[model samples]
Target: MDQVEKTLNQNRLVLFPADQLQPGERKLVKVDQIEIAVMNVDENIYAIRNECPHQGISMIYGSISGTMVTSKPQEYQYGMENELIKCPLHGWEFDLKTGRSVFSPNQVSLHIYDVRKEDENIVLYLRRSPEKVIVQDFSCNHK
Candidate 1:
């Protein structure tokens, strides 16, 4: 009998198509060997690290809603929309524009990346080393 061989390669995951998401939806995207959360806030797109720094949870899987659309501000801004993502576990609110944690006043922000639409595809490039991996735990990658 011959032993079966198995190996895991990360290059097999498909993120999403450019048109799969609409304005106000968030999608988990992996590109350039990086995992991130892509969000379409009022037609403008944003890409940030999918893992929440607080507890290393996948922010993409969390409960996300447009803060501007759901909770309107007292004063209106020129380019402001409901684009805040609230963590379902701990209820940490983050502003999609700056990726800053609203729950923290001291500039706790997520790792942001440069995302653009190229022809018919949405592309995201790594801005820096991924601080946390949302798909796996800190000490384990077995999953």
Candidate 2:
């Protein structure tokens, strides 16, 4: 077998059948000590942490929407259609592709996992670290 196949066979955790998941649907799964929310958007599969960072609420029941941008007053732009998942408690939105929070893109984010399809099964690979946290400099310049 190849390298990917070897890794899959070694650390792959099968969640469910690929055909059972439909577009715009999410499934909650527990592997080891982590809770993951597997989502299907327009036939693409994505997985993220099921707990919200703010209130520890379940993010599986969160709503999905497109990214909304407002340049100025009365001007609104909507892009990245069906790619954002909003927290159910405080309405915090996170990008499904990168797991970056819409409100605080540089700081807070979710633990996104890498998913793959293996012979009709949906598999989740084990990550070295459960979550990736990035810290940015917040200094200001005075002129």
Candidate 3:
């Protein structure tokens, strides 16, 4: 487990495991004290930081639907669901793919990780400030 930086590098990280994350399932992974959300989008996998940049809320427990997360508080009275992770306090919508918030543009975007499949094993790569953090050795036999 190494430290992931802000720039993506191909050789820095290793493949953890190859497991298809089905829809509606949440995968919690840790990379150097950072909790990441490994979500399953269709047949592919995507990773992003679990914390929301708006107010530091865990995105793993936020509103998740398909590939979109709601950061803002849903207006149930106005009928707002399947929108985005609405922060539950302020109301924001972050696109799952780009980790961009619809509410705030200048705000920092969610840290996105690079993921790829290697012979049925899922490998993730993250860019750190200095170097790349590679997390191999994920126990796929546990569950």
Candidate 4:
């Protein structure tokens, strides 16, 4: 038997097995000295920074839930369930997909990385610069 070849990309990190983290589960991982919160929200995996913009607390420990929204002035509607991560200390909620603050989107935001399922491995791409987010997909570039 021969050894199976893995990914050649240096920026890609094999976080864990796909079966290890089920839907609605969260795992805290560190890559290049940065703490990241990898969550499986209804099987749509999302990765966000563990640091909160407010008090610099660990966001991974924050409660996962939705907030109330309203279109009319006097109406209140609950929306965006399980898509927001609250700051454990300050109760500030941030969207997992966009990594932006719910109340003040432009003012505060978390650094989010690209994540996907590569075969049986859950991979995350560590992005150092904003412009170099996706220069190319190595897996697609090759066979």
Q: Write the per-residue lDDT of candidate 4 for residues 32-132, one digit (tens) a residue.
A: 45677777777888888879988789877777788898668888889988888888798898988899998889998987878887787777775341121
The window of 10 residues in a row where model 1 has the poorest summed lDDT is 134-143
In the range 1-143, model 3's lDDT, one tens digit per residue, is 23232333443344354553554445677655777766654455767787878788867666643333445676323222343443445556676667777666568577778776656666566545423233422222111
Q: Which candidate order results from sorting by TM-score in descending order?
A: 4, 2, 3, 1
- Model 2 steric clash pairs: none
Judged by whole-model lDDT over C-alpha atoms, candidate 2 comes out at: 0.71
Per-candidate Cα RMSD to the true structure, in Å, reads: 10.6, 11.6, 7.3, 9.5
Instruction: Put down candidate 1 lDDT per residue, 1-143, tens digits, no spaces.
Output: 11111224211222345576566566655544666777766667777787777887777655545443333668643333356666656878777667788667366877776666655555544423333333221221110
Candidate 4 structure, TM-score to reference: 0.77
Highest TM-score against the true fold, candidate: 4
Error of 2 at 117 (Å): 2.5
Provide the clashing-pair count of each candidate structure: 7, 0, 26, 0
- Index of the highest-lDDT prediction: 2
Per-candidate local distance difference test: 0.57, 0.71, 0.56, 0.70
Candidate 3 overall lDDT versus native: 0.56
Better of 2 and 3 by lDDT: 2
Q: For model 2, give the 10-residue run with minimal summed lDDT.
A: 134-143
Structural similarity to truth (TM-score) of each candidate:
0.58, 0.76, 0.60, 0.77
TM-score of 3: 0.60
Candidate 3, which segments miss by more than 4 Å at Cα? 1-8, 11-16, 65-89, 128-143
